[model samples]
Target: MNYIKHLNSVFELFTRDSRLNPTHISLYMALFQFWNINRFPEVFYINREEVMVMAKIGSKATYHRCLHRLHDWKYIRYLPSHNPYKGSQIQMLKFGTSSGSNTGPSSEQVEEQALVPYININKQNKNFNKHKLPKNENEVLDFFKKEKWPANEAKKFFNHYTSIGWKVGGKITILDWHSTAKNWMLKGEEIQKEKTLYGPSQKRDNLKIIKEKDYGQPL
Candidate 1:
């Protein structure tokens, strides 16, 4: 298989897929790495724990769910094993045509053709901001409300991020504003829990400390 072509094709497919989350992408990449290590075998056996560690997945439920979803999406063929000594089997579905084929264009030609659309897309998006952001405070408020978050928290999130140029730690640019907002809410919850467990007079500087951490990076 042409590794570069395969990754480009799958990533292009991923862009069009709304059902996939970061966990799904992480798991898929981990599986792809294992497939690579095994010399791209037609089928391979994998230990659940080993895959989970490679994927940085802590929960088995999440790992299994994403794995099954990938299978259901026809990205891979999964064969679960009942025996404790044997690992589960996986067959990665190829997205690109075989490089050894004689009928198609040469490898260089194929690569160039595959990159043409991306070149056009980059040119078209030259003037557009790549990050996802709300048009206004109202949009942010609406999203928070939809997620059952406090209206005031929406304002806080919008104002805070806006002041920082929608970046985490005033350095890294945020790609998904919605996910950032969700993380903001989660941090707020943690702060609230801390206050409840200790006292209302807890130092507010802790919030500033938390905000200093880079939230733009994926978990």
Candidate 2:
């Protein structure tokens, strides 16, 4: 599977669910993509730098912050990978139930669940500010008008949004548009609106098509 595309879809799924935080959701998306690509059934070692690069995070500190956040969220369980000679051992992270109920006899079971941490990404934050398009009435209308995006194309648009930054509120609004866009795209109507949806620097239109051959069976 194309890891990047799969990551986009998985990110969308998590964004739709209000229960997940942006950082934890992004970490899980990266973890799942790595697992799917490597096809490792057992524990796998991942370096902090690798995660920073994969998630497009700014720094080692930011990467570790997100990692700790995911651990505290119970989305993943990790431990130091053993090495004969090393400064800091690699990390082995597992994605799935950390509750131990889903593991088999041979599987590693985490006994104590860590207390969840509160890492809020609120609207007033700088990250959130980056996603807020012009809220002005005329500007908003003109933004959409220039894009000529069908109301239904919201899903594709939101996927693009969350891929760049976790815009939770924007995601909620985009989902509503996605529902509307689906019907229009299906009927092959609103071609002009569809063209308008692809704003500058937004490549949601160039999304990689996942063909049946790629799946090798019904998805």
Model 2 lDDT at residue 21: 54
lDDT of 2 by residue, 100-217 (tens): 2322112233343333344333411323223234333344344345558543454444445546443222322221222222222333443444567863455555467755445311
What tens-digit string does per-residue lDDT give for candidate 1 at 98-121? 653222112221111111111233
Report RMSD (Å) for each prediction in the order shown. 17.8, 16.4
Top-lDDT structure, candidate number: 1
lDDT of each: 0.67, 0.41
RMSD of 2: 16.4
| Model 1 poorest 10 in a row by lDDT | 109-118
What is the number of residue pairs that collide in model 1?
0
Evaluate model 1: give its lDDT: 0.67
